[model samples]
Structure formats: C-alpha cells, structure tokens
Target: MTSTTQQHPLPLTGRIAVVTGAASGMGAAIAERLAADGASVALLARRTERLDDLALKIKAAGGEAFGVSVDVTDQSSVDRGAEEVRQRLGRVDLVVNAAGVMLGAPVQEARIDDWTKMIDTNLTGALRLAHAFVGDLVKAAAEGRTADLVNISSVGSRGAFPTHGVYSATKAALTQFSEAIRADLSPADVRVSSVEPGMTATELGANLSDEQLELLGSTFAGIPPLAPADIADVVAFVVSRRRELNLSYLVAVPTRQV
Candidate 1:
C-alpha cells in the first residue's frame, strides 16, 4: 500500500524576515514566531546585547536568526542594517516595523523632548525602515514570493486617551501611512498591513511618568492586557495567507477591553 498523506512545508519556509525592536516585547515575540515558522530572521534594534541574547536563544531552538544593531531613528543606521540583512540572509520578503515609544503626560505638561522622541521613533522610524527595504520586498513579490510589510500601530490611534495625545497621533499617522502604501504596493503583489493592538503587556510604558503610569494602571484596571505573543500570532497569520490574499489592517485587543 502506498502512503498518500504528505507533510506540507511551513508557510514561511525559505523566506527572510526582518523585525525591528527585536530586543524585547512584541518585536522579540514576532521575530521568534517567524523564525519558528521557518523563516530566517534578522533581529534589529539599538540594544546589541539584547539582540545577541535573543539570536542565541532562537538558534538554540533550531531556528535561524542573527542580531543587527539598528537605530530606526537614523537613516544611515537603517540602511546599514538592511545591507547586512541582504548580504547575510538574501532578499528580505518580510519586514515588521515594531519599534516604538510611549511617553505619556498631560498635553500642557508634556516635555517637548518626549514628544520629539515619540515622533522620531514611532513615525519617522517606520518610514526609514520602509524606504530601506521596500525595493527588496518588491523584488521578492516580482519573483513570485509572498512579500509583506507589517506595521505595528495601536488602538489608541482611533480613540482618545487622557495623556496619550502625542503617542496616539504617531500611531494614527502610521495607520494612514500604512493604508497609503498598501494602495501603492498592492498592484505589485506586495502585502502591506497595519496591526493595531490595544493594551498589550510589554515594556512600552516603562518610561512613563509616575503620574501617567498611575493613570495608565487605572484605565485598564480590570481589563486583562494582551500579550506580546498574541500580537505575534496575528502578524504570523497575516503574512501566512496566500500571496493573492491580503489582510490589510487588524485591531487586536483583549475581550475585557471596552
């Protein structure tokens, strides 16, 4: 008797993925998940030590991974990181822009520097990454491979929060930019997606002022926060879809969140 059933290869099996902010939190989770799914992952962040630690763990788990020191706030840094990924891992077919900062304070009391940091990291950073890798993504798509650019936005983009004005603005801008680029890239068979998560459990708020932290704690007092792995799962699902299908935008939140 001939056995007919056969195992299918992993969806991302031969793809190359790059994840920014990969030292911790959502970015780290996403990189790990992608690598486990069979893609060669390049972890990018300013924290070289953390990235190296993550790379070692991924390799130990039988996944291919390498760490690259990248500061998304700097164009030169991003360009260099992209070059390294290309030279080491081949053309990138998956790029996840997950680097961000959330420094919350009352509008009137908000430090100008905080606002600048947020804008530079959460908005311009995403743009720098997209510019550095869009060509590779396009080439991958043209070669009949699944190509994706996923941006991590936030539900705050659509709702008003007491002390998250600037943060929300950056996310809102990200969402809009994601949509515009989707339009431009869809014709080339490149999938672009914006994933908005609500109240995820991560270090995104570690830099908040004590008062703002208190407010943040109270706002989600009873609602359980989503985990980084949760967002990573969403991203994996989005990119694993058939090349002809696109999950353009998604909002992920805990059920307890109103």
Candidate 2:
C-alpha cells in the first residue's frame, strides 16, 4: 500500500512585509511575528544598530529579514527606504506604519515643537510611507495576492485625556486617514486597517513628562498593561485573514483598563 503525505503551507509564505519603528517595542514584535509567519520582513527605523541586531536575530532563526535606517519624518528617507526594501525583498505585500511619538502636555503649556514632532512622525510620517509604497501595494494586489496596510493608533484618539491633546489628535487623524485610504485602495485589493491599543508596556512613555509619567503610573499602578506581543498578535491576525475579508478597525485594550 502506498501512503500519501500532505504539507501545510504557511499563511504568509512568499510575502514581504515592511515594518516602521521596528527597532523596538510593538514594531519589533510585529516584524518578528511576520517573519515567523513566513514573510520576509524589512525592519525600518532610525536606530540602525537596533535594526541590525534584530535582523541578525531573525536571520539566525531561519527567517529572512533586513534592517533599513529610515526617519519617517523625511520624504526622501522614506523613498530611499522603500526602494531599498523592494531591491532587497521584492515588492512589499504588507506595510505597517508603526513609527510614532507621544509627548503629552496641557494645551495651556503645550510646546509647539512637541506638537510639531508628534504631527510629523505620527500623521505626516504615516502619510509619507503610504505615499511611497502605495504603488508597490497596488502592484502586489494586482498580482492577485493579499496586500495590507496597518496603521498603529492609540485609544486616546477616541477618548479625552488631560495633556494628551496633540497626541490624540494625531491618532484621530491617522484613524480617519486609514478609513479614507481603505476605500481608495479597495479597488486594488489593498486593505487598510487601523489598530488602536489602549496601553502596552513599551517605551512610549519614556518621553512623557514627570507629571504625565506620574499620571500614567498611578492610573495603572497595580494593573498589568498589555504586552507588545499582544498587539503584535492582533496585527498578525488582521493581515492574515483570507484575501476576501478585511479587518478594518480593531481596538485591543487591557480588560482591566475597561
């Protein structure tokens, strides 16, 4: 008697993913998870050393990954990074705009520079990346493959909080932009999604002021915040769905934060 054996295919096999802010935190986790899901990943961030190390680890784990030093705030840098990813990993099938900054200050004492930085990185940076790789995404979709654009937003976008004015505004804008672009890209089979995470144990709070830091600390003193891996899991799920379905809007927050 002859026996037949079957091999299961990886969900993201032969796909290429580009993750901004991949040097650490949620971006790093997302990159790693995508690589694990059989997608070749390009890690983009300002921290070349961190990216390099991450790439090494991914490669060592029998996955394909490359690190590109990119400052999302600069159009030229974004263009160059996108070109490099195409050259290295072929056309990008997935792009995650995860590079962002959160600097909280009351409106009365808000620093113009901080707000500007937030806008540049959170709103404009996402736009720059979208503009640069959108054509690539279109091409990928035209090839009858799944293509996705995932934007990392914050729950602050939907809620009001002291000192989170500008940060929240940027996230809100990102959410709206994602919805608009999703409609535009749907014809090309490219799906756009915005993920809003309430709180996660990452470096996002390092830039917070003393008062903001204290507020955060006291707010979740005993509650364990969501982990970077938690958000990464959601991102992976959003992009891994069947080509016919799209998970447009998702909010993942700690249950206790409810």
Candidate 3:
C-alpha cells in the first residue's frame, strides 16, 4: 500500500470572509474554498453580474455567499462596498485583497497611462481594500475573534522579466506594504499574511500581448502552471491556524518550477 499525506482542512464554520476580485480566477477559487470550509463569504469585484453568478452557484451548493459590486480604484466605492458587506454579513473575520490588473510593456513604448493604471489598480487598489477592512479586522481582534488579512503577491515581485518590470514592481510594493501592516497589526489579534505564487494559470495573465504572453510562456514552459485553486488552498491553510499562530507569509509554486 502506498502512504499518502492527508492535508488539514480549515474549520471556518459561520465565520465571515470578504474576497475582492471574487468574480473569477484565483479570487473566485478562494471564495469558493472558504465557503466550502463553512465560512460565509462575500464576493466583490467590478463585475456585479459575474459576482451575482458566482454567488448563485455557491448558494445553490448550500453555502452561505453574498456578492457586492466594487471598483478598487475608486476609494469611495470601496468604502461603500465594505460597509454594505458589513451590513449584510454582520461581521468580517477574514479579508482577501485579490483585485488587480497587470500591464506588460517595454519602458520605451509603455504608455504612462498604462503604468498609472497598473499602479492605481494593483498597488493602490490593495491599499484601498486594506484600509476599508482594517477597521473590521480591528473590531474582531478587540472582541477576541480570529481574524486575517491576506494580500496576494507574486514571484514576479522578485523575478525580473523583460516586459514585466512595471507589473513586478507593483507586486513587490504589495509585499512590502503587507509586511508593514503585519507589524502594525501585531499588537492586536488580527493577522496579516502575504502569499506569493509563481506563474499561475488564471485570467490574471490575459492582459498580456501575444509577444508578451510568448515571453511569459518561455519562462513558465518547463514548470507546471498552478491552478487558481492551489493558491486558494494555501490561503485556507493560513486562516485555519490557531488564533495564536499567525501565518505571516507563504510562498507556493509548482514543484516542477523549482
């Protein structure tokens, strides 16, 4: 008989978790995983219709899920969306800032507009969600509830690619920002964690041009691209930890990649 390691499933019954960018890709996968583990999930993204569809699916499957429409680039929109989630869900225990945009362009031809959009959507976007949710997390901590704030980063944050310069910088900034928040929130029971995944197979890379996609292809060819669910599993594990054990950082990649 072959021996296999059994993974620990997260216990999240009745807990409330909010996931941004939950319309599709890793965001959707993460939301589904949390709901499956017994948490009530609130999905947020720019596409309200998509969010509605996902929420329907989760509800059909006998899970608790609610969807909200939000644009992370707009601070006021994020603020309102957060409050709406709080009102509907009653409380928030976990917040995942998974909303983002990626732009690949050479420095010479990359429009400043593209760069600005990338910054606003990727870096500042996370900032907006975190700011809006920090209050809820603090409240949970004060009440001695288990809480978490997870920011998705990327291996590109450290790896240098020909056209990935701008996008990489944005993810790197997210990592640093998460670190600072982790330190600041340490006194409270709220845990801040960063998860960095490499070459994931998701819509996240759909923004690339043909040539840019080819470039990414070469770097990822030998390595098996991880599905969005893999990253979601990592996050689930982090949150499942005892309140006393804070998972500060997690880096997961396909085994073949290394």
Candidate 4:
C-alpha cells in the first residue's frame, strides 16, 4: 500500500510581509530573502528609486514585491504606508522594522541634532511601525497564521562604547521596548523579536564623522564585519520557525569579535 502525504515547500509561501528601510542594506536583503521564500513583500523606505529598483529585481526573480515610500519617523507616513501594504498585499503577516540611524560621537561633543535623529529613527520610528501593524499581527496570529514583528537593534545596546553613547542608549531602549512588547504579544502567538547585530558592512555608518569612523575602525581593527545577508539569514530563520517557537532576542556578531 502506498502512503499518501502532503508535501509543502517554501515556508513563507503566500505570506504577506512588510519591511521598513527596504531600500538598502540589511533591510533590502531581508526583503529579497523573504520574497524568495514565497512571501509577497512590500518594501518601505524614503528612497523611492532604490525601492523601485529592488522591487523590480524581486519581480524579475519571479517573486512578488511592491515598493512604497515611507518615512518611519513620520506617523502619517507610516500610517499611509501601512494602508498601501494592506491594499496591495491584503493583511500583513510579518513586519520587520529595520529603519535606524547610528550617528556616533562623544556625548559632550555630540551634535544635538544627531542624538535626536538617532532617537527618532532608531527608537520612535520602530514604535510607529509597531503601532501601525500590531493589529494586523494579532489578527493574523489569531487566525492561525504566522505573525512576526522583527526589530533590528544593535550590539551597542548591550554595553558602552567610546563614541556611541547616545546611539547605544537608543538601541538599548529599543531592545527593552522589544521585550516589553513581546511580553504583551506573545500570548496571542504574535512573535516579537529583537535582532542585535554587531559590526556590519552597510551604509549605516557612512554618515559618521571622520573622527568617529577612525575610532570605530580601530575598535573593529582586524575583525571582518558581518554582511547584510548574514542578518537577513538570521531574520529568515526567526520568522520561519514553527508557530509554537519564538526566538525572541538574537545578538549576531562576527565570530572573531571579542
């Protein structure tokens, strides 16, 4: 007698995913990876051109993708972006808040503007996105679908670094926030995860001042930083876990880093 069993491939097939900061770096890589896993992805970022380019690339690869301009720091922008995703992809089953800024400097010498930008982008921006999509996440989970909220934090959140005072503070706040929300949401089966990545090769540090860069460069001297795809892989693993499993907090750093 032949046994009959259903074989399913592609874990995220038919899932609708919304990724912020999808125009570049880890965000872009995560969006692409999710699409490849069979999710219809909505790419959100202020850079419309880059989002368009990524969307096109995903489509060419036979994956579903839509690009939308979203400034996470702006409540109205986030709301509008959420609406666009809902209209284009139906209810969202996954939300990844990857928008962040790392402007490092000695606290005394730091530009107030830089601190504000980090707080707004790295902390409050994540809150905005969460607020806009928590309902959908809860509903999806209640309906027995996978629902995930992933926040991209930093290893800087775990300790003090010479020039990363305010930056570290913001990330620390984000990490704590993720924990608090996870407590509230996990009971509903909505997974909330914080991904804290250590030194990574991305445009995240491109805007740093020369002094800060030199300081960071020496600090990470011989260690090869992680690639965006590495973080993307972690995210994919987290969201693809079984419904009963939730990898809540993950810190990903280079193997050689102390």
Clash counts for all predictions = 0, 0, 0, 0
Q: Compute the lDDT of residue 207 as modeled in candidate 4.
A: 88
Top-TM-score structure, candidate number = 1
Best of the candidates, lDDT: 1
Give the clashing pairs for model 1.
Answer: none
lDDT of 1 by residue, 96-172 (tens): 99999998888878689999999999999999999999999999999999999999999999999998899999999
Q: What would the TM-score be for candidate 2 when compared with the true structure?
A: 0.97
Q: If candidate 4 were superposed on the true structure by all CA atoms, what would the RMSD be?
A: 2.0
**Model 3 clash pairs?**
none
Q: Which one wins by TM-score: 1 or 3? A: 1
lDDT of each: 0.95, 0.92, 0.89, 0.93
How well is each residue in 1-258 modelled by candidate 4, as lDDT tens digits? 999998888989978999999999999999999999999999999999999999999999999998999998889999898998898889998999999888877777859998999899999999999999999999999999999999999999988799888889999999999999999998999999999999899999988889889988998899999999999999999999998999999999999987
The C-alpha stretches of model 2 lying farther than 4 A from their native spots are 1-5
Worst 10 residues of 2 by lDDT: 215-224
Q: Best to worst by lDDT, what's the order?
A: 1, 4, 2, 3
TM-score of candidate 1 to 2 decimals: 0.98
> Which of the two candidates, 1 or 2, achieves a greater lDDT against the reference?
1
Stretches of model 3 off by over 4 angstroms after superposition: 1-10
Instruction: Tell me the lDDT of model 3 at 139.
Output: 93
TM-score (all chains, Cα) for each model: 0.98, 0.97, 0.94, 0.96
Per-residue lDDT over 164-203 for candidate 2, one digit per residue giving the tens place of the 0 to 100 score:
8999999999999999999999988999999999889889
Instruction: Assess the local accuracy of residue 240 in candidate 3 as a C-alpha lDDT between 0 and 100.
Output: 87
